[model samples]
Every structure is written in C-alpha cells, then in structure tokens.
Target: MPPRRCTASAAAGQTGSDSDLDEFIMRCLSCEEQYDMDDAGTCRECYQEANEAEEELRLEIDDLKSKVSFLTLSSPTLNPSTADIVLVPVDDSDAAPIPAHKHVLSCRSPVFNAMLENDMEERRSGTIKISDVSHDTLCAFVNYLYTAEASLDNQMACNLLVLGEKYQVKHLKTYCEKYLIAKMNWNKAIANYAFAYQYNCKQLRSASLAVILDKMDLFTQNEYYAELVDTNPRLVVEIYETYIGKQLNTAGTL
Candidate 1:
C-alpha cells in the first residue's frame, strides 16, 4: 500500500471517537473509583444523601467521644488522694492497694453500692477486700469502672470478665465477652466455651459452642477436653446434648 488514509475523522481539534463521547464515565462520589454507565453506583441525589448521612454519623461519633472523655475519671494511680475507698487484693496482699472513689464504684456496681450505701463493714473501714483476684486484675477492674475502657488481652479479658460477673458490672462483662468472642478460634474454642459457661456469658458460650460443634471430630483430641471431661462431666454432657439437638434440627430442616 502506497499511503494509508485516515479512516476515522475528527472535528476541529477533537481526537476521540463518537463512542468515547457517549461512554459516560464518571467517578463514584462515595468510593471515588471510575465507573461507566453500566457500573454506575448512585445518582447525584443519593450520593449527596449518603455524604450527609456519613457526616452526621461522624459528628455523632465525635460528640459521643467527647462525652465519654468528659465522663471518664482520672486514674487512681495518678490521683490516689482523691479516692474515698481502697481496694486490697486479698489474693495478692503484698501488692499495693488500689484506691478508688466510693461514688464511682457504687454507680458502676450494685455489690459496691450495697456495700457502701449501707452501714457495712467495708463502708466503716473505708477498705474493701477483693478475694481471688490478682493485683493487676484489681487495677484493671478499677480502671474500667472509672473509664469504661480496658486494654484487653485474652488472659486479662478473662480475669476482668470474672470480676465483672462477680461484681455485677454488666457493661464490663459484655465488653470482655465481646472481646473474647472476637478472638475466638479453633484453638481457644473449647476452653472459651467452658469459661463462658462458668461465667454465664450466653453470647460467648453460644459462639464458642458453635465453633466446637463445627470441629467435633477433633474434640476428643483436644488437651483441655480430657480435663474438662474429668472435672465437669455435666458440661460435656450438655455439649453432647446440644450437638444432638442441632443434628435433629438440621435433619428436620432437610
């Protein structure tokens, strides 16, 4: 061929074809990814609504954060003098006592409230002896009562959950239970189920039991299973009962 002719023509300075003009590509306002008409995410009105909703949620979250900050008390470690009562860990008596406000404790836990409000020995002595809890656990429990927060690892969460349950601190119990549930896996499932049953934590117990049921084939091989069967045969029976019930339900569904 001698000289090739331009098969596609363009108007004035324009170089793109008619197909490009009609392609209708636009970036998603929410996700900020480019999309064509076929993959269009939302209309302008819906996008604006979504943005407004997101902003409102952000403002609400900020407000809640500020409120939490305002409500949170200063740590007893930082200002021990302001505390009206002291909590001594009976299990770890050598450890330094944990100081706390009576009002704060009373507000957070019914057990504390009853102990402090009435003419109890704890109120008279201005000291409460907490048994079977380590110094670290007592500190964490007191800190959570003050701030409604805790930095939780598995052991710490379990410790605090036990304290929370005994003291009737519902919020702390729920928090720790949720944390344990989030960290639940096959390795921890059996132990967590037993712990949850012991603590009366329904959510955690159910989740852990589900995990255990899913891996029932390996149940007998688990190290903790032998101990659990030896110590709490009733709990093991309950597990078998639950598994049977689930199987029956599944068969019914089928």
Candidate 2:
C-alpha cells in the first residue's frame, strides 16, 4: 500500500512539471499576458519581446544582403577595351591635368618634403636626366610617393616611362607602359619610342620598335616622319627597312 502511494506522488509531481513547461512555451510563442494549462495558456509580455527581436534580426539580415550585392557587382569600366585606360574628361579652358588637390604636395611630413626638394635639385643639375618628364610629372611623382595617388594623362604616359627608367621606378614605369600599350595610336607609339630609346628603356624600346615596324608604311606616309627620323634616326631606319623594305622585296616591285 505504501509503495503504491509513493508512485502516485511521483506521478503527480511529473504532471505539474510538464504543465509548467507548456505554460512557458505558450507565453513566449503566442505573446500572451499570462499562461496556464489551467487557464488555456497565455503570457503577453514574453511574446512581445520575441516579436521585437525577430524584427530586429530581419532588418540586420537585409542590410547585410545589400552589402553583399554591392560587393559582387563589377565596375562599368571593367570592359576589356577600357580596362587599361582611365579617361578624364577635360574642358578646353583647364590646361592643367586637374585642379590641385590637397594630397598632391600638401604633406606635413618633413622627410617627404626634403625628398621632393632633392628630386628637384637632381633634375636641375641634369644628374637625374630623364627624357620628356616635365615639372608636372615630377609633381605627380612626389604625390604618388606620399599619397599613393598617381594621375597620368594620355600625353604624359611616354614621359612617365622615361622617368621610370631614369630613377629605376618600376611601378611607375609599368603603369605608363600598360597605359601606352592600351591606347597606342601609331603616332603615340613613335613618340614613345623616341623617349624610351633616349632613356635606354629596353622593354619600351623593343615595344615601340615593334609598333613602328608593324606600321612602317603608315609612318612613312605620316607628316610626323621627319620629326621621328630627327628624334630616333637608328630606329626610323631599322623599322622602315624591316617592314617596308620586306614588303617591297616580296612583291618584286622594288
């Protein structure tokens, strides 16, 4: 009889524990003010907090999704034709590359200023001789060293190559070469060749020579031929003979 009573007591305790758990789940899930299995399960306060947390998490997810989409999208200029070139639109009135920005020569570092001054001194003495690099190009170089912002115009590309060769600035040289290769008109290639040769830029010289050789007939026909011969006589003759002479000989019409 005593054993039977003990089992009955344990069963009663288990029933009470399950009833309490059901009440708690209902209160949290259903947003009820109060819940009881006795009163059909309700607790409003816990439910309201759960709803608020869900809305907060939903907004956070949306924000993260927007960021993900932005990161995945590519720039419009990533097209193959425009990949190597950065075009800056200019008005006829603005003769300079662009308006001066604070980052150009406005560094507060004395070490950087001294370096620029030294560069200027080297340039004046012709000790740091480089073909076609102007004061503006020097300014750009200083800006790049200090701020890591390099702006090379279409016309300045050739100059940058010479500057790179003179100072052994490989990064700047590569930047100019890539841009020149991308936008190489026949005339620009000829001009670049003259500067590159003067500076003993072997890679650029070979590239320029190849461009001229490939378009020898066109160069001979261009008004710039005389100027090119004056600047790089050796290259002019070599490219002319390589392409034009070969064409004439092959045709048996020389």
Q: Please give the distance, in angstroms, between residue 133's alpha carbon in candidate 1 and its true position after superposition.
A: 1.0
lDDT of 1 by residue, 27-113 (tens): 666566666668856667887898899999999999999999999888887889888899999989699988999999999999999
Q: What is the TM-score of each candidate against the true structure?
A: 0.85, 0.42
Kindly list the per-residue Cα lDDT of model 2 for residues 1-254, writing each as its tens digit: 01112244453555566554542322324433544456553234665687899999999999988876664423322332422212122222222222222222224334323444665653243222223445566546544443444667776776656656655666667777777767766776777677666766667667777777776658776666789777768777877667767788879963
Q: Candidate 1: lDDT of 180?
A: 97
Q: Model 2 off-target regions past 4 Å? A: 1-135, 244-254
Clash totals in order: 0, 7
Best by lDDT: 1
Q: What is the C-alpha local distance difference test score of each model?
A: 0.88, 0.55
Weakest ten-residue segment in model 1 by summed lDDT: 1-10
Q: RMSDs, each prediction?
A: 7.1, 21.8
TM-score of 1: 0.85
